[model samples]
Target: MGILNKFLEKTKICVIAEKYSVAVEYAKALGCSKKDTYFEGDKYVILWTNGHICTLYQPEDYDEKFKIWKVEDLPIIPNGFWIKVRPGKGQILNSIKKIIERQEITAVCIATDSAREGNLIGEYTLMAIENKKNVYRAMINALNEKEIKAGFKNMKEDKYYKNMTLAAQARDEIDWLLGTNLSRAYSVIYGKKYYVGRCKTVLLNLLCKREEEINNFKQSLSYGVITKFKNDNCEYAGRLNYALKSESEARSIVKDICNKQGKIDSIDRDIKSIEPESLYNLNDLIRAVNRRYGYAADEVYDIAQKLYEEHKLISYARTDSRYIKKSMINDVKLIVNCINIDKFSMKKSDINNIERFIKRCVNDEKVIEHTAIIPLEVESLEEKYKLLSTKEKNVYDVIVENFLNNFLENYEYESIAFLTKVENYTFITRQNKVITHGWKERKKQDKNIVEVKEGEYVNVEDSVVEKKLSKPKERYTDDTLFEVLENPAKFVEDTKLKKILRESGIGTNATRALLLKDLIINGYVTRQQKYIIPTIPGIELVKDIRTDKLLEPFFTAVIEQQLQQIQDGELDKDELIKDTIKFLERHIEELKSIVIPDKNNDPIGKCPICKRGNIVRAKDKGYGCTNLKSTGCRFFISKEILGTYIDEKQVKNLIEEKQTDVLRFKGSKGEFSARIIWNGNKTQFKKF
Candidate 1:
C-alpha cells in the first residue's frame, strides 16, 4: 500500500531530450533545479536520451541461418522489421519505460532535435517503451531558454511527425535489405570480407570510373601562338583561337605575325554584377574548411557541433538549407546586431549595410528542416571566440563572414574584351576592373585592365609559340568529391537522368562525409595528400560489380525519392517496403550467376621448416605451409596468439625477424603488453 501510494505521487509531465546537454538546458528553463540521471520539478520530470536508444535488429537476430554466409540466403528480407534496444542502453530504456508506464504521468514531451532523425529517435524510444500516453513534439532549433519555452508553449501532437518516422524506418530497412544480402554474397564468392552499401558502392563506382579515365589518358603535344601588343604606352596579351598540333605550324603563324602592326577590330565593355554566394550548408561548410585548412569532413563536423552545443555561438550545424525562414528576420537582425564586426577585419562601410545584406538571406521557401548555419546572438562574442579551438574558430569566422556578406552590396565589375587582327589571324584579350568592392572585401577578384580603343593600331611587341601537353583530369580532393556527391548529376551524361539525380543526391549532407570516411576505412579508397585514389581492391570490386544495378547512382536516388515521398505522405510505407523486397529478390538471383574472379594470392613468406612450400594465408586461420598435405609439413600458426588477432604484416614480421613489434593482448586476468616470438614449431609471447 505504501509503494502504491508512492507510485501514485509520480510527476504529471515527462520531457525527453535527445542528449544530456540538451536536457540540462531544458531542465534549467523548466524550473527543474534538482538533478540525477533526470531533473525533477513539482509537476514535470525532464529526462534525456543518449542519441538513439533503439536500432533495427541485425541479420543474426532475425534467424540463425544468417550466421553463415551462403548464396542461397541471398535476400534476407524479414516479413516485419523488428526493433531492439541497442546494447549498453538497456538501463536507460528501462528507466524511461518506468516513467512512461507511471499512472500519474499524463503526457510526454519529445524535446529532441528538430529533424527527421530526431523524430525517429523519440518515436523509437516511445515504441520501445510501449508507450500509449499523449505524446507531444517540442520542435526547437537551439537549446536556448527563449526557444525552449516557445517550443513548449507551441507543442504539436506526436502524430504530426509520423510520416517522418516512417521515412526514417524505410531508409533503415532498405539499406539493410541491400547491404546485408549483397555484402554477404560478394564476400563469400570472393573469399574476402567485402562490405557493401548503396551510397558507398555508388561513390566507389564514381571514383573507379574516374581512375580508369585517368589511366587510359594519353598526353598529346599542342602548340599555341601568343603575342603581346602595345598601344599608347599600354600593353595587352592575346592567344590565337586555333591550337596547332605541330611546332612547325605554330612557328609559321608566329613568324608571320612577328613585327607586324595589328589593329583592334572591336572593343566591347560591359558591367558585370556578381551576386553574393548563398549561405553555407553542412556540405558546403565541409568543403570550405577542407579546402582552407586541410581538415577532414568528420573533424569539421565535430568542431561545428561543439560550437553549437557547447559555446551556443551558432545555430544547428547539421543542416542542408542555405536560407533562413521569413519569420526569422527579426531574430536574424538581433543576431547581426550582436556580432562585433568592429573586432573583425572589415571595412566600416560594409558594416553599415548589415541590414541590406541580412534581407538577402531571408526566404521562406528555401528553408528546410533547419535554417542555414549562422552565428547566434550570444552575450559575449569575443569570449566565445577565445574558448573555441583552432578549427572551431576557423569555422565560426567563416559563418560570421558569410552572414555579414548578405547585408553588403553586390560585387560590381567591368569586363573589357578586345579583338586584335594581324594578317588573317584573330587574337582575343579580356580584362576585368572592379567598380565596387562590396562582398569582394572578403573574396577579392583579380583586376588586370589595359586601355585600348577600337580600330587603334598597335605594334606586336613580341611573339612566341609554346608547346604544351594536355594533362589528364585531376584526381578528386575532399572539396571536389563533396561537391560531386552533393550533385552527382554534374558528371552524368543523360540530361533527363542528370535532372533526376540532382534533385536527390547520392546521400544526405549529414551522411556524405561519413560515406567517404567509410570508404577509406573499408580499404575501398586511400588518401594521397588531398586527393582520393582507389586501391587495387577497390578497382577490382568496381570491375566485378559495375554491371549490377547496385552500382547505379540513380537507383539509390530512386530509393531516396521514395523515402521522401513517405515523409510527405505521398506514398504508403508498407508498399515501399514490399517493393524493396521484390527488387532484392530479383537481384539476388541475378547475382548468383556472376562469377567473382579470385584475388591474387601472394605468399606471406617461405616456410622455415620445410623450406619448399610457401607460407600462405589459411582460411579463417593465421598462416600455414602450402605443402602440408603433399610433403607432410604440418606447420601452421593460429590467427590469435595470447587473445590477440595477428594481422598479415605482423605475421610477416614475426617470420622474418623471429619476433613482432610490441603488441597488446587481453587475457583472462587483464590486458598485458608483449612481443610475439615465432618459435620453430609454435609461437610464444615475450613481455615487453
Candidate 2:
C-alpha cells in the first residue's frame, strides 16, 4: 500500500521538444511561465533538444583498421549500426536522462517536428538514454497554442511511430555505408577527395550531362519574313509559317508579298480561363522563390525555416503536401482573418471572400504528414513587420498572395487567332485580350488586342526578312534544376523506369536543396549567376565512375520505394539492410575491377616552392604541387584572384617568367587591373 501510494502520487509529465523555439511554444501552450534551459511546472516539465541529440557512428568508430582508405577494404558494412550522443550535446543528453529516470516523472511526450526526421530525433534521444518508460507522441503541424493543446489531448502511443523511426534509421545507415565506402574507394583510386551520395551523385551527373549538351550545341542561322498588316486602324504583325534556310529564299518570299493585299481567311475567338495554381509544397516554394528573386534553393529553404521557427508566421516548411486537411478549415479562416492586407489597400469584399476561397485548398487525401505552408493566426503585421528582414518580408508576401489568390476568380481572357492569305502564303497572328483581371492582378499578364473580321481585306504596310540563329537549351538554373530533381521522367527514356522515377524523385522535398548545395560544396558543381555548371573535375568524375547501377536515377528511385515500403511496414528493416549489403558488395567488386583513368596528372607548370614537383590544376580552380603527400610541400596557387579566373596561359607565363601581364578583375568596389607574380613561396597580385 505504501509503494502504490508513492507511485500514484507522481503526476509529473515530461515533454521533450526537438528545438528550443519549439520548447518555448510548448511551454507557453502548457501554461508554464517560469523558464530556464528547461521549464518546470507543477504537473509538467518541458525540455528541448537541438536538432539531433545523437547520430550514427562514423567509420573510425567501427574499427581502427577502417581508418585507412584502401581498395582491399572496399565495402565497410556494419553488422549492427550503433548510435552515440552527438558531440557538444552530452550535457543535454545527461539532463534528459536524469529527468527520465526521476521517480517523480510519470510519462514522456515527444513534441518533436511531425516527420520522419523528427521521429528519429526523439527516438535517438530516448535510445541514448536507454529509457523504457511510458512514452507518447504529439503530432501537430504548427506550434500554435491551440494546435499544441489539441495535440496533447490527442496524443498517440509511441508504438504507432516505431515504423517511422525504423525508416529513418534505415536511411541513415544506408547513406553512411554508401557514402563512406564509395567516397574512400574513389578518393584512393583517383588520388583526389571525392564525396559521394545516392542523391548527390545523381545531381552531379545531371549537371555534367547538361554542361556537355551546352558545350556540344551548334548554332544555325535561319531567316523568316515578318509582314505587317493594317486593318480598321489597327496594325498587327504576322510571321510566315515556314522558315527559310537562306537569305535569298526569305527575300524572294518577302518580294512576293510586298505589293499584295492580305485577305482574312478566318478569325477565331475563344474565351480561355486559367485556374489558380495549387498551394506550395517545399519544392514548389523553392522553385518559385528562385525564379522570382534569383535566390538559391538552400537560401529559400533557410528563409522558410526561419519564418516557421523564429517568426511563427508560417506552418511546417519542410512538408511535401500542398493541401490542407478538411479539419483545418476553421484554422485557415482564422489565419485569413488575422492577416493585415491594408498595406496593399485591398477592399472589404476581397477580405470577406477569403473564407470561401480557402475551402478549395482543403482535401483530406492530399495531406501526408503535414499540410501546405500557410500563415499562422497572428494579429496585424504592424508590430511584427519591423522585425522581419527584407527577404523574410518577400517570402511572407508570396505565401499571402498565394492564399489570397484562392478567394479570387479565375483569370479570363479571349484568345484570337487570325489567318491571313497573301499571294500563295498564309500567315497566322495570335493575340490575347483580358476579359477579367481576377487573380492576375497580383501578376499581370500582357493584354494584346487585334481588331479584324473574317473575309476582310488588309493592306500590307511593310515586309522584311529577319535573320535568326537557333539557340541551345539554357543552362540549369536553381529553379529548373529543382524542377528536374522533382520530376525526372523527361530525362529517362524507358517507359516503366520513367514512371518509377517520376513517382520517387532523386531526393525528397526536404533534402533536394541540401543535395544541390552539397554538390557545390564538394567541388562537383559551380554556380555561375543563376546557372549551375559542372567543373572540369566534376565532369570527369561522373564520366569515370558511372556504371549500370551506380549514379543512376532508377537506382535511387528503387531505394526510395523500398524506404517507403519500410515506412508502411510492408518490408522489414533487417531484410532491407541485408539486401543493401549484398548490393554494395557486388558494386564494390565491380568498382575494384575497373581501372580508374588518371585525369588529374596533367602538369600546369613547375611548382615555385617545391622546385622539383610540378603544379597541376586542382579542384575549385586552384593549383597544387604533385609532391603534396611527400616532403609535406603545401605549394599552391588559386586560379581565381579577386573574383576573376586567371587565364591558363597567363598562369603558365607567371610560372615561367615570375610575372604575367596586367589583368582586369572585378572587385567589391569596382574593376581594377593587377599583375599576377610568383614570389618564390606563393603567388601575389600587384595593382598597376
Candidate 3:
C-alpha cells in the first residue's frame, strides 16, 4: 500500500514515469501503507515508460503506406499521429488500465516529473484509460523524500500542465512531419533511404560535417627539441624546441650545447588564480569517465543509469545544468560532509578558498527543478560507497569529490616562465607549478602540475630533438560532442544562425548521447581506435548535400528557437510545423538532384569464396560475401577478437593476400605475424 492507499482506504493508483525508481517513490509518497514497493505495494501500482512507450509509425509500419516511396502523396503528414501501446508493452499498459477501472479507486494521480514529456505521457495515458476518474497531478522534480512529500502536499490539477503537454505533442508532431515525410522524400528522389528528424538529422549533420574536416585536413611535418639534465636526486623534463625550428636544427643545437652549462637567464613567476571546476553536467561526466576509465559514452551512461535506478544513490543523470537548486543546498552539504566526515578533511586555507569560490557560483536561478547528480541522502551515499563495483566506484568518487571540491577553496598556484641561455641562444620554458593545491588536494595524486622553485636548475633528463608533424583536426569524442553541442556554429562559418544555436547547439543533452550511438550503429560514423571517424557513407552524405542548410547547425539552431517559441506560446505549433516541412521539402528536392554513389561500390573486399564478387558489411553481422544469393558464397568474418578490433584492411588482407602485416600484440607475447593460409582454410600467428 502506498501513501495514497493509506489515505484513501482500499485505493490504488497507477504510476507512469520514465524512471522506474522515481515512479515507485512517487507511489510511496502518494500514500505509503506498504513496504517493498516493487514486490508488495499492490494498493498503489507503479509503472514506467522508457523515453517513448510509442513512436509515430515508420512508413513501412503502415499498411499500403509501406510498399513504396511517393512524393505526390508526401509531405505524407499522417491525418493524426496515433499512439499505440508499443508492442511488448501492451500487457503493462493493460494492467495499468485494469487498475484504473477498479471500483475502490477514487481518483488517478498523474505521477511524473514536472516536464513537457511527463505531461504528454499523463495526458496520453488519461485518454487511453477510458476511466473518467477525478485527476490530480503529482509533479516533483527530485525523487528524494523531502521533495516528493512536499510535492504531494501541493498537488495541482492536470489542467495546470496543459501547455507542457501541448509542447510535447508539438515536438512529436514535428519529428513525425520531418522524419517520415523527409525520409520518404529523400528515398523517392535519391532512391536511397535517407532519414531526417528534428534532432536526428541535426546530429547526422554534425557527424557529416566533422567527417569533412577529418578527410580534407592536411598534415604538415614539424619538429621539437627536448633537453636532458640530471641533478643528484631529481630528473626533470623540458622542451628545447622553444629555441629552434626544424628537428634537425634542434638536434644540432642540442649536440653543440650538450657539454655547455645553460644559465637561467630570466625567471618570471606569478600567482595563478585557479577556480574550482564546475559541477558535472551529464556530458561533462560522460566525457570525464571516458578520459579517466576508458569507458565509452554509452558505457558510462549505462553505469550512471544503473546507479540512478538500481542503487538510488544519484539524482537524475540526464540534465545539462551543473548547478543545483536552492532547495538542494542542505542536501548537497550533507553529501559533502558524508564523504569527508572521517576519511578526508579540508585544511583551513583550502576551506576559506573553496567557500569563497562556492559563494561566487552558487545561485538560485542557475539551477532548475534539481541540481547536478548527487547522492539522495547520507545513508545512500555510504551505501553506494560500499556497494559500487570498481568501475562504478571510480565514477562515484569523481562525482563525490567534485561535489565536495565545489565547496572547497580555490587552488592557488604559481606559474613560472623562464628563458635559459644556452650557446648564445635563448630557450623558452614555461612551467605551471602549483603553490597551493587547495581543492585539488582532494585528488593530490592526479595533480597535473608539479612544484618548481625560482633559480633552481633541475635536470631535464632524456632530451631529444624529435621530428613531429602538425596533426589534422582530431575526430569528435564524447568531450568534443558536448563542445559541438554547445557551440555548433564554430564549425559552420555562418554569422546569422551561429549566434542563435550557440547556446543550445544541435540537440538537448538528454538526446545527445543517444544520437551519437545511433550515428555509429547506423554506419554513418565509427570509432577507429579512439577516434570517431566518419565512414565513406557519412562523408559523401555531407559532400553530396553540403549546400543544404538543413544539414548545417545553423538550421537546427533556428529550429530550436522556433521550438522554444512554440513552448513559450509566442508562436503557433501548426505554423512552426508548416515552416519546418517547407524547409525540409526544399532541401529534399535539392539533395535529390545531387548524385550519391551506390553504397555497394565501397567494398570490404572481394568475397573469399566467390573470388569474383564483393564483400559487404552489415550491422550486428560483420562482413558477408555479397555473392551469397547468386553464387552461394556464404563466407563471413568477425569484427573483433578478444577486446582488440581487427580493421577492414586486415580483413581484406586475410581474404585477398592470406596474411596480416606484422603487428605487436600487447602481452609478454611480443611482435607476431597473423596469417590465414592454405586458401583461407586455417589461421595462425608466428613470432616476428
Per candidate, the number of residue pairs that clash is: 2, 0, 12
Per-residue lDDT tens digits for candidate 1, residues 8-94, read: 455467889888888888878878875657887865788888899999888899888789989887788787888999999999999
lDDT of 3 by residue, 245-321 (tens): 56677777767767665655677889987876688777778887877776777778878877766676677776667
User: Which clashing pairs does model 2 show?
Assistant: none
Worst 10 residues of 1 by lDDT: 1-10
TM-score of 3: 0.76
Clashes of 3: 12
Question: Distance (Å) between predicted and true CA of 129, model 3?
Answer: 3.5
The TM-score measured for candidate 2 stands at: 0.86
Q: How many backbone clashes does candidate 1 have?
A: 2
Q: How does each model score on TM-score?
A: 0.84, 0.86, 0.76
Stretches > 4 Å off in candidate 1 = 1-11, 341-348, 351-359, 442-448, 491-496, 546-548, 596-688
Clashing residue pairs, candidate 1?
357-406, 357-407
State the weakest 10-residue window (summed lDDT) of model 2. Answer: 1-10
Question: lDDT at 488 for candidate 1?
Answer: 81
Predicted candidate 2 versus true structure: per-residue lDDT over 225-326, tens digit per residue: 899998676788998878889999999988888878999898889999987777888998888888889889999999999898888889889999889987
